[model samples]
Target: MTTMTPPVTPPVTALNALGFDRPAADTRVVVAMSGGVDSSVVAAMLAREGFDVIGVTLQLYDHGAALGRKGACCAGRDIHDARAVAARMGFPHYVLDYESRFRESVIDDFADQYLAGATPVPCVRCNQRVKFRDLLATARELGADCLATGHYVRRIIGARGPELHQAADPARDQSYFLFATTPEQLGYLRFPLGGVATKAETRAMAAGFGLDVADKPDSQDICFVPQGGYAAVIEKLRPGAAEPGEIVHLDGRVLGAHRGVIHYTVGQRRGLNLGGGDPLHVLRLEPESRRVIVGPRAALGVARLRVAEVNWLGDGAFADAPPGGWRAQARVRSTRPPAPARVLPEGADTA
Candidate 1:
């Protein structure tokens, strides 16, 4: 009788950057392409790594209106550029019509928020309501393992599960705009460029990979708004948004009149045009009364603030958190570094 030798198995490969314990060829990734270099480089890098990369871009607004609109992402020109990148990478590309959804979820809310006398970050709302929520669903329906974007934020595995951390690049860290990212969305999202040390490196990667968007400029804040005029767009969206309003001092004295509350924001100190000896800053806006309250810089300083609509990404259950609360670093603006913070949980939703 002949002795038969058993066949040996191949060595197993460890999990990938995306946390998938499978071969890149066997895994599928849906990339949200904004027709910008960062996202283009991501798709190219994954394609070069042998992963099944699918490029999807959203038609966020009217194609006719978006024509010739530069320095804006998700515009018609951006959509065309994204298609070119997909073609260059030799992958199947898709363009989803999200005009109606964008108008409802982002544009309308932006106007409403400004009309309500509040400073709104529309990028956060777009990510929360549109990309991470709605677009992520489309990725799942396509049988993708995960959805990825070019945001400069890290998603690392902590003691509990996936945790959101600031990107290594401090100058390019976009954590403030992403504070609304829910714990569930954190699990399925990947940020390849978060580990990058600089935006230059991203551009370098694009150049090395021969992507056409290597020299493309980054998108400005409020991509839908042209010329960075927040008030102009709001006025165009909602007629009479810039109605005349009384500019009143903190001491109940009328200083002057303003075009609209939308033209002013809290902490603003310039363009008062009051011909003043003492400088005045915008303290608050009362849309109901259509009045702009002006005061000194000292009035803008506040030690305590109650933040509604909180998003918790802690490792443990929020309710199980310590009574004294979690000690963490927090920032009020993206331009400033995080300061010491005590997070006292009042309920399951807020702290």
Candidate 2:
């Protein structure tokens, strides 16, 4: 008699916390450790949760030169701290030398943008070109199921797919610097600290995990440019970037001579050195004419701006926008709040 056997049922794999359809132990995650309390806490938390975690820190610059730098990240000291955290958590840690990549991608672009009279946010470029692009590639090469970071930006899986959202803690939200995150990168990236209510909470968790960076101060200035000295760095990158030029008023009157248009940005007031006149603010920077145009604060008001090389992270093709435009909220700077904006798609990548 042939006995009929019941078919073996396949176990369903529910999505894990990191959104992988498997158990935490089976999912390999790579945490981009910046040696800060926030990232260390993320690594520890994920390790405690039984996930196979690998800690990777990018030595973004010359380690010897970065040593003893306290207010910046990706330095020699940070790499050591990251390694220590990985050791404590019993996870494999690797430090990749990304100095050349950083210089070619982020640093060079920063200098060129200044020369072009445009204020460039190097952190955003670093994330867009190096960390999220190159480092994410490295993570995949390591066989990581996902790449996690300490960025205080939430990645929500909406009906469309993974959507970048502001962190639960608005004060720590890094959505501005992360605007360039592409959809494909969003799918593989996870931000574990996005839901944390506060930095204090992250510090407490780090302390609980016996991590060394529990009370470490947050990195303030750019990692490559120390002490917020943008002009000096620019000069070093491109000689004569700080060439002296005239600071002229909007009325076409020369107010005073100044050192380089790179030293000033639109809406600057304090460093003008006009001495005795109406409080003048930087109206615009003219790199070609080597001019720093100044005028009354009201002159700095902008009605519209043309943003180029736009990276659209919205639902559909940016070119497929409604005839009028898309009403949205836009944050021009990280320090400012989001304001209402009508994004008109001029082309595939501009609005």
Best-fitting candidate, scored by lDDT: 2
Tens digits of per-residue lDDT for model 2, 158-225: 88899999999999999999999999999999999999999999999999999989989999989888
User: What shift in Å separates residue 84 of candidate 2 from its native position after superposition?
Assistant: 0.6
Per-model lDDT: 0.88, 0.90
Candidate 2: clashing pairs of residues: none
lDDT of 1 by residue, 202-272 (tens): 99999998887889888875788777788988999899988898999999999899999999989898887
Q: Which ten residues in a row are the worst by lDDT in model 2?
A: 62-71
Error of 2 at 44 (Å): 0.8
lDDT for model 2 comes to 0.90
Compared with the true structure, model 1 gives a TM-score of: 0.94
